[model samples]
Target: MSDIQDRHDSGGSGAGCGCLAVALLLAVVAVLLGRPFLTDDGDGGAQAAPEESVVATPTSERPRSKKPSGRRPGVVNIFTEQGLRGVRAAGTGIVVDPSGLVLTNNHVIQGATEIEGTDTDDRRTYPAQVLGYQKSGDIALIRLSGASGLKTAKFAEKWEVRLGDVVTAVGNAGGKGGTPSVVTGKVTALDRQITATDQSDGSSERLTGLIETNAPIKPGDSGGPLLNTSGQVIGMNTAASAGFDLEKKGASRGFAIPSAKALEIVRQIQRGEASDTVHIGRTALLGVQVRQPTTPSGGRAGGAYIADLIPGTPAEQAGLRARTTIVALDDEPVDSPGSLTDMLLRHHPGDTVRITWTNAAGERRTTPVTLGDGPPQ
Candidate 1:
């Protein structure tokens, strides 16, 4: 598992400042559709560069481990290659059905041009097709092509999870393949909210009602299962805390979406529900591309500067144009493009919002615009 950066209700600006494409637009769509990842521009930091994929080859054909009764045989390793950048991301998944329907974090598979997975039984990789995703829930479901008769992870029937209860996290730590990493810890808290960022693009997401634990949720651990002492999955490991300052004590914290919540969202996604918070397509549109401001020293310029507005879109209809600087959404301060994207996460399609911006005339203006939905990216 790689280091994950996080903050409590207060969010960070995220590190490794640079211009990635507007991939966050999809996140905004997720928000508008009803579930928001509360992302923001925290204090500026150096953005981490994209990591190259490392596929390890076996030297010897080691015998597979004997299956332990009650252990989850359906836990899978999810691997994805996103965009032309080929920014690879890996995480854990749980097989939900014998037909190879798998569930994991949306952030784990978002923007993936190609997705694949390795089942625990055979450890053989298979091509995966995304069924659909719910951004607000931060969960996604995929179907392994030609996969069947796979074992599935079992979920706890009730909210048997309690503070101080022992738990185990299983996932691909450090994005490394092979057997999954199992880390043990106790539940520290529950129903907590935190903001998580994509190291690949500096995009942030606000997650709520998460199960907090001291378990080492690392990179590639996202979408893995948080198992109880009985080996039944109680939660889905999602975000890990990193970049803690002196004020904070100990190592980074890890958070997971409650299995009940995650499972509910997955079922909704599987049903292809088209409700306010659940949508079947790509993302909602504001029809505007934003760029970050640059400091005189050639560093990052905070806040999103409108670069282009898709003509005939809601933004144009609301009188927004290129060269406008978005400073706030619904009165929330906007310090980076991610901030605006984060704010958009709180809204849904067909919803009207008060967007504040600075025009080329140096005047601040506010407008209420209705959001529109678009096809998947």
Candidate 2:
């Protein structure tokens, strides 16, 4: 997790400066609690980076432990390599079915070209493929190859959760591959809402009806189980407050998506119901990075400006180039990069769509391009 930096006034009286500093210190930054492990080259290739160490120091008198634990039959560590930028990310997942159906956060495997899972039960690594995902709800389902007879996670039957209930969170903290980390705390609130921002692009999404707890859930814990006293999962850990001092007691707080809501989305995905927010299969790629362009007066332009195009992709083969603006897709207006992504999600590989763009010469051009199979967007 990274801090959301805020600019503060430098000039002030000593007492006023002290007050402002205190206010800044108390401000909470909600961040998605997952660790991305690899850096990206300018082109779409991964460059190896040093692994991040776990933050194991306790924040309270009742210390959280990072020691290796016994086999967690249902939990697995997930590793993903993104297709476009070649960045690798790590997170936790829970087995929902014996046939290796895993449930995790959408952001954990988003844009992944390859996925692998290491089951804690047997410490065996297996290849994985995305089944479906609901981007709006931040939920996703994946299947591990050649896996069977695995233990499935136990869900609370009644789905009853209350404030002050003792709970434990288990996950692959710091992207460490082995026995997951364990942290215990109490549920502090329910039906909470938080704005989760992607550190890479600063894009944000609102997560509502969350279960808030005082657990020290750290990076790499996303999609792990938030269990009750009986060890039945009640929620899935998702986000947490960033930049908490390790020595400060009770300074950390975590948020989770309730299991009931997550399961609902999972069932929808299993049924192959593709909605406005749910994508049924692998993403279709236009293969161009886009940004908002600026006019001569320094105002935002109307269309998505092409930043770069991947080699041998649909956009490149169709003669799209950097510095142009994509105005429409299949006659649908593309006002921004997000709009273009949303439109692409509605289509699949082999689906041909007409694209309209404005070149550097100010000439508008239209062409039909067949979409290609790509990683999740």
Candidate 3:
């Protein structure tokens, strides 16, 4: 189990959060029939919330249904295998529509070439495709192809959460991919900011304005639902603290993204809002590993050095190779590895661009290549 044990402040310690990633969180335990499955022990030592308490009317309350159900069958298990990065991840997803729209964490399925989901009520698994995703915010939307009659999860509007409110977390605890593990705990704090590092890949994310809960968010619990007493989803379980307890299981505290904020990002993705930081359809990949050089002061220097590129990818098709340094994209100077990613995100698959780089022989070169739709980043 994961423990994100920290009291937060709104002032925000904003640092080390940026674009570029190495390995996504590997939530998988086995590769069954070429599919990745995450396995874990049940909420090893997490705590739950109190039995019964009056629902406090906080400032964030929404117009709730008169009779809110306490049992959710809309929770779906997300299983992914990232082929390129050799990473396997698992998490939970909430069905939002009868037509099979599902919401999950971007990190849960990052770099995944094959995605699948199984609902709580159905034992049959369904293949899924990426609808959209925002890496900076760590949220994503996927669609289960050819699915119907799926139960949808209800979101608590009006921001009715409080510091002491009881909340339940439901998720596929051990990458078991069937039946979720339910844990309870109080809303220990709100609007907390945390920088969580993926132990599998060393990639880090600085998440802000999160709901801090004493409830345990285990491995394979990413993208699970943090539900209120009414069984309404109030937040999406995203990151758990890995601070001091990096080597200890169930030592870090758990954090979640507010349902309202997550829903807003999903709406934008559904509406095809592609920007420098957001991708509306499938993700685009150049198929190259980049590294940043340091300046004389040991600070990060400009230019992204191409350490390697995937064979047959656009990077290779454009005559780009390893040991090359990217200087600019579409005429924009590439200052860092993250900057190159930022510029590439502004475009979509099939779009053509002129890539400028310095060859290993110390000569500047330029080539035009069309981007390719790869996996979710």
Candidate 4:
């Protein structure tokens, strides 16, 4: 290396030193071999280069060029009643069913001006039909007029949506009528309930089953989408910058209802029944916050364990106590908390439910009782 440098400095007459050419080959070999020995960006004090990230993307098997922008389809611009009045308070919604059932937030269409849906190509505008809506779940169902051959949004399973996953929201943030917009963020939290006042009254309503995220949701972005890394619909954007009591000091703490529950409301609307929204005087509330058990078995180790039961809830009223294990519902054994909730949700609040379980003492116990108010967001 020294000989090459000396020859180059001396400006050797023999068509530039041959040593320089040899040294150049050796230098190229050193770079090729040195890279493997060096630590990656985080471990090493120095980084390869900012553009290296861009360059590396091309070499990836699933190259960046092949990645879809999620701009092809499965997105529609939502027009509300407010739009007629030139109010920019509308939100976005996604088609989840072949029959044109759309899922969005309850507040999005609470006072809709005129319901309209526009596909990626904004040139096509169709009058949307509002089938029904459940304010409690922040879910509503709507369909495009004679929407045949429409692309449906793909739904991501719960296991697929992990915290810290990259997500994006596509909606009309400015609610600029036909044109739609987009926002991107990360999944920051989940299973959150925010007690905050809605539009009008002083009282606050609790939003539940919410997957919290930092998605930049604006006023008109409600009922939009919370798409996973793969751009699959995972949740419906509800509220953001919610001034709730618990997390009052919050910013971009947007909340969304998971796709699992949102699909229920969407199905109701597609059915085209006026009363698709099942209104009940009082629904069953287990009043217990439980986690899904790890295994399925004969004893309490595998079933729903009462995490916290309201003092005078339906379960409590029926002699259901704290620390009690829920082994079976009706006659089927419940293997996990999800099973118990699923079973309980099947029945209305006033509906009768038979809970059979083996107490901590191994004594079999059965309690028959009516359900209470459900957890309505």
Q: lDDT-based ranking, best first?
A: 2, 3, 1, 4
| Model 4 ranges with Cα > 4 A deviation | 1-72, 82-88, 177-179, 241-251, 271-377
- The digit string of per-residue lDDT tens for model 2 on 1-377 reads 11112211121111111000011000000111222221111221122111110112124334323332322459988877654553455678999999999999886776668888888887778899999987667799999999998888887665356666688899866666577778888877666656554432233566676777778887667789988776778788876323222223535677778887888888998999999998898778677766666789988777777767778888889887777888998899987655677788898888898889998889999989888887764
Model 4 lDDT tens row, 1-377? 00011111111221211100111000000000000000111111122222211111122233112232343356666654432122323456777765566676655554343566766443456777656566446677767787767777777543344456577777655455444566676766555555534221122345554666666565556677777656767677766422221132464556667777777656655564334343222224555544333324533356666645555566667787665677888888887654554455445656787888665676879999776643221
Leading candidate by lDDT? 2
Give candidates' CA RMSD values in order: 12.2, 13.4, 10.1, 23.9
Candidate 1 per-residue C-alpha lDDT over 71-166 given as tens digits, one digit per residue, 9 for 90 to 100: 356788776665423355566798889899998877666656677788877777899887767665677888899998898888766335556667
Candidate 3: tens digits of C-alpha lDDT, residues 56-108: 24564355443323447788877776676554556678898878889988766
lDDT score for candidate 1 against the true structure: 0.62
Report the Cα lDDT for residue 31, model 1: 19
Alpha-carbon shift of residue 6 in model 1 (angstroms)? 25
Sliding window of 10 residues with minimal summed lDDT for model 2: 19-28
- Which candidate, 1 or 2, would have the higher TM-score against the true structure? 2
In order, the Cα lDDT scores of the candidates are 0.62, 0.67, 0.65, 0.51
Candidate 2: regions farther than 4 A off: 1-72, 198-203, 240-250
Sort the candidates on TM-score, descending order: 2, 3, 1, 4
Positional deviation of residue 9's Cα in model 2 after best superposition, in angstroms? 47
Worst 10 residues of 3 by lDDT: 27-36
TM-score of each candidate structure, all chains considered together: 0.62, 0.78, 0.78, 0.50
**Clash number for model 4?**
12
lDDT of 4 at 372: 61
Question: What TM-score does candidate 1 get on C-alpha atoms?
Answer: 0.62
